[model samples]
Target: MSPRIPLIFNSRSWNWAVFAVLSCSLFSGCALLPRPRGLARFPKGTPATKAKLEQVKPGMTVAQVEAIFGSPGHTSKGSSHDNPPFLSWTNEDLTAAIIMFENGRVTQRMNAGGLK
Candidate 1:
């Protein structure tokens, strides 16, 4: 049988292998760091500001409004194609905003409870 080769940790090749593994493990650790909360794209249960509500305008679609303010908290009784179906959103403080839709497009917007 052939003689088995010995591994010497002091050798240059062994030192390079150790260094490469350490460098890779150190760099990979950065990926596990937590991101800052302020950078969140969408925050849940956030109050709608007046400026956000103002983004809703006449002629915008129901889907478009939902994209801006999320889903409506309340919907008036009417069919989707009704002459003036209403959609409304309310914050925890009871500040509320309303939108009127006709033919699947915005007709008007109203707000109450000092939205700002």
Candidate 2:
């Protein structure tokens, strides 16, 4: 009877040890799981105002263009090859688009989905 009791106790303890190890391994695996990507910083939606589409004539400066159409949605320095350096503007919704000259004039303009 004494020997049987010891055997049973040992079996129970071994089962508990196995359970603990499996639980720890599962929890650690979850920690190693990959995280999802973050959302875009810019707001998302269609352009509320109609896009203005017009030819951008040469010699327009940056400021003058902004005056006619208000401020641009976003602006950045022109690329190395883009001549007559300018900044681009898009509507708040990012649908409408325009480009202004470095001197503050409208060099190019396109409306609703015109520029890709």
Candidate 3:
């Protein structure tokens, strides 16, 4: 004749393991969440100030332009000697504009977002 033995497992151990994993995951995800860099660094949709825009003029040098408008959105110098340089300013809110210079003076101003 053979004798049979019964086995016992604690369900609380499984519950504890699950709770620990969930707690760790929740805390870790919160720690990993991205934080805002800062206002000075510029974020999306930063408004353009009239004071800054007024400082720009057609014939101003690149350095002068930077002083007035911080830094340009972009700059490009063409390979062809006949081509003039360009400067662009952009609002993070999708407001777009361009100022064109000829012989170091502003010759044209374009605004796509209707800025006067």
Considering only N, C-alpha and C atoms within 3 Å, which residue pairs clash in candidate 2?
60-105, 61-103, 61-104, 61-105, 62-103, 62-104, 62-105, 63-104, 64-104
- TM-score order of candidates, top first: 1, 3, 2
**Where does candidate 2 have its weakest 10-residue lDDT segment?**
46-55
What do the candidate models score in CA lDDT, each in turn? Answer: 0.64, 0.46, 0.51
Candidate 1 regions off by >4 Å? Answer: 1-44, 71-84
Candidate 3 error regions (>4 Å) = 1-47, 72-84
* TM-score of model 3 vs. true structure: 0.41
Candidate 3 has which clashing residue pairs, if any? 58-105, 58-106, 59-104, 59-105
* Per-residue lDDT of candidate 3, residues 1-116 (tens digit): 78966543457567546644653454355456565565432344324455566667666665665566565443334343344445556554324445555665565544434444
Q: RMSD to the native, candidate 2?
A: 25.1
TM-score per candidate, chains pooled? 0.51, 0.36, 0.41
Between candidates 2 and 3, the one scoring higher on TM-score is 3
By lDDT, rank the candidates, best first.
Answer: 1, 3, 2
Candidate 1 achieves a global lDDT of: 0.64
- In the range 14-79, model 1's lDDT, one tens digit per residue, is 855674465345435533666576663223454666887899999998788878886544333346
**Superposition-based RMSD of candidate 3 using all C-alpha atoms, in angstroms:** 23.0
Q: Which candidate model has the greater TM-score, 1 or 2?
A: 1
